[model samples]
Target: MEQSHQALSSKSEAFIEKENKYGAHNYHPLPVVLEKGEGVYVWDVDGKKYYDFLSAYSAVNQGHCHPKIVGAMVKQAQTLTLTSRAFYNDQLGPYEEFVTEYFGFDKVLPMNTGAEAVETALKICRKWAYEVKGIPENQAQIIVCENNFHGRTTTIISFSNDENARKSFGPFTAGFIKIPYDDIEALENALKSTNNIAGFLVEPIQGEAGVYVPADGYLAKAKALCEQYNALFIADEVQTGIARTGKLLAVHHENVQPDILILGKAISGGVYPVSAVLANNAVMNVIKPGQHGSTFGGNPVAAAVAIAALEVVRDENLSQNAAYLGVVLRTGLNEIASRNPLITLVRGKGLLNAIVINCDEDSDLAWDICMKFSEYGLLAKPTHGNKIRLAPPLVITETQIHECLGIIERALNDFR
Candidate 1:
């Protein structure tokens, strides 16, 4: 595989060496030295540009360094940066109004990252269960799917099935029941398993689990089951929201609204860390003052950036673009799959998609394939060992999409 690509430039080696010397060995990022990004492309320090297929794990749905989002952040930073929930700022009220209205929710609790939004949602659900749902204190349970990837926080990882994440994490948080993804029967059974069930926290489409889009009506049926059992259906749209999945949210495809809606990533157009959990007053009202918040959660910069980012999604019709281009991308992929035995399966929704390489989960074939992709001027990454997630920024045009597909095809041919 080393013969297939050029050696790392000295500048790249220096940056990598610095990180290895000073940074924690947490992430095994692809050996590339990216220094710049604009729209759908990112340039390495050595100036080799590549299509940004990963999109910062779908955080840059509005594309990289979007003028509107960056402009909003910069404009807000210059005017006002931080006024915590202790003191209200001009940006927070408008952001609350706009976000609640945009997502058709009664209220929103803003946060700074996807995991924080998820953690916020869990706290809200548990609080609501105890306060409103009449669940016994300290006994409320939330159901999660197997092979889920909500985040890396201690509480979040407690329910995760991935052993590597759970190893040495110790004394996992209790009160979470695990079930299979896309299984309505498993959901009903779990809901029936406990009267103290607080909610069912789920990813509308399990992105980190290799873009595992569920069956049609799985979300709607799950919501109905939640209603049947009086458990809140919390949809973690942190990765699947903001037009990455062809709809405003993946749940929109099924016309099901989550009791607690968690959003992050593209909410700030990848320029700032912004996340939020939205729910109606009845559920959100459980929290009193000083109950939960972050110092920078509702900062002016996040609010301004999120407003602009969401507006860009609406004005640019990112949802429509994703829906149309999804068909194009998938059709091209299926054609490639038909001719290539190496690619075993293609499945996903909208811009969030993946191709399963014909290898075991422990195999490094997908990682090596991704390395070849990087060498060919296209950037992508492997998840769960054998799946190459192919989500580019929603701002990517059709010509760019075709160009990326060509790169992928040529790169796969090299493997052949």
Candidate 2:
């Protein structure tokens, strides 16, 4: 068994070397080379299996290669794939209606990636501010939180506080106000001080910022403030939506409806790249034809895949499952933390959880721990150098979650 594992490791190393040589040096992925996945499990090229803890940064909420989503995509692909918005395709209208109704929005603007949806939302908000809210053109200001991880676009990164993502990408697009996360006072102050505020974009849980769950009532209070100021409250649920944070949308945890909602990642159950921005007619209708569009945004396959993905979220009750299993995961991790000194704190909401390592920001302890976890047949990644985010697929069962907990503890014990 050891020899076979060694051979598999060699094969994996060869694949990694090839990728390093051929592929862009942008992502420093785990050494494992995965070729297939099902549910919460992924198999490497050598057929070694491991639990998928990251879920592609919460993209695969329905689990890897969900059959329903894949079936829908396959059927749609076979039928009709792309018909640019120039002509009406059969699937686009039904999908628009279904998604709008599912999320309680009057309309939706579809896009291909989370960044594109975010950009769309930003453009819409600015336009609405000038056209509807009576703000001057090019003077619209959108408030964003520090340590935000929206996407890699220049306009999006202009306001990001992450030095790695911001440095050397200067001359960023302006018209953004940066505020501290979870600070209602800062939010209110910005609203009061600003005359041309268009919208306040925020993440309910701050997934990429190490799953930083804000204080209770923060979102509710912030939404109230946005309403008070007549500014749009935009929820970026790209990472925290679709049962990843124990709710269909994390904002639902506060029972507050955002004026503008940006959704992506798991909207198609990780089967395809599909994103959308939803708003009422007053806000979404600001854009005229030829103002904004994506050629492959509302294609037939994406529409079918997204509908099936959302249906699975409802039929399988993934949100409730995530709510229940999140408690289990956090409780198990807390128990383990009590016995492990290396773990300083465990924080997050639902399955979107992370552990703060008792080490410096430059320390590689978290990365080392993830490598050890991979060795033990589980997969996770580190963020901010000293934190590791553990978010598995919502389709995970209690038994599988408990098994993962055992593996996590064993890995921690080995490291300790």
Candidate 3:
């Protein structure tokens, strides 16, 4: 039996090998097998070390295997793992309090993933449209942006302008309007044209769509428009919040508070899956008992882990770190861009930044540069085709930033 178990383990590794060979070829990921991680670095299956720059789509803002978050997870698991909404657990209330107070919201609805939180926000907006705004039942509309990426869910992808994400995923969900991002006039025109609009859903900086940063005052202007039209301004900060973008939330950079805030990724410091929707009573109260929920949402383990994760963001001053390091990284990249025509632009706020490669979208240029980066001991992935997003863990130190910069410079030089 023991020999059979060993054979099964070998089969497991072979299974991973075979799956990659014959599985759905959706993602073109960098060829690196991660086995373990700590702080701002990950080791491959071969035990080679590399600095993690993408942070699992900014999910590891607290770095990998954060001790406090892991401790909370372990302790909570020992006590109780899950008690569905059929009954309450002790951890939910305190977690709700911590997250709401931290983000300056009246209440929070926890979920297991960023996409679920986004769907919850949509439901809340629709319900509020019916109950509060008196928009006829199913005619309510939500405004989304061009190149905005909410998630992979059917309804979320319905509004996506990216052909790849939306192509084979329909008959899509309806009742959404798409506008040019960072353009206030487009948003105003949509608002003026529609009366049944319930919300404006946006990413402060469109992360998956190549780390696109909107124009200055774009968020504030949109917020004002939403207020004037009595529509909810929903910010999908799953990638831009929790100090990934200098501020705790990127909307705060413009002094604009979203009515419905969706967060995930780093909520549990990347130790576990945790996501949430934050809003005041007027919007959140629309979701009553049995209206919306997840079996593992706000489970004791997730709640405890998320609480510790948020505390780490505060006690460690990760926001400040991101802000400072962002300046250093951006300035460094700008200097490099001055010498290399291959780099068209370096743009972002805080640590959420990207470099636009001046090459054909379908060419191997971006992928080649990524390989060069991997060789230099830093890991980053290209978005779309000609853009590479760089978002290291918020816990990265100045020395680490400089070291990573050296690696990036070397890779850029190789590209040249």
**Most accurate candidate by TM-score:** 1
User: What's the TM for model 1?
Assistant: 0.99
Look at candidate 3 and tell me the lDDT of residue 274: 97
Candidate 2 residues lying further than 4 Å off, grouped into runs, are 1-8
lDDT of 3 by residue, 35-154 (tens): 899999998766779999999999999999999999999999999998898998899999999899999999999999999999999999999999999999899999999998999999
Query: Which candidate's lDDT is highest?
Result: 1
Identify the runs in model 3 with alpha carbons over 4 angstroms from their true place: 1-16, 21-24
lDDT of model number 3: 0.91
> For each predicted model, how many residue pairs clash, with residues at least 3 apart or on different chains?
0, 0, 0
- Quality of model 2 by C-alpha lDDT: 0.92
Runs in model 1 lying further than 4 Å from the true structure: 1-5
Question: Which stretch of 10 consecutive residues in model 3 shows the poorest summed lDDT?
Answer: 1-10
Candidate 1 lDDT by residue in tens digits, 1-416: 33355589999999999999999999999999999999999999999998999999999999999998898888889999997788878989999999999999999999999999999999999999999999989999999999999999999999998899999998988889999999999999999987999999999999999999888989999999999999999999998999999999999999999999999999999998999999999999998899999999989999999999999999999999999998899999999999988899999899999999998999888988888999899989999999999999999899988988899988888878
lDDT of 2 at 231: 97
- Give each model a TM-score: 0.99, 0.97, 0.95
* Residue 345 alpha-carbon offset, candidate 1, angstroms: 0.4
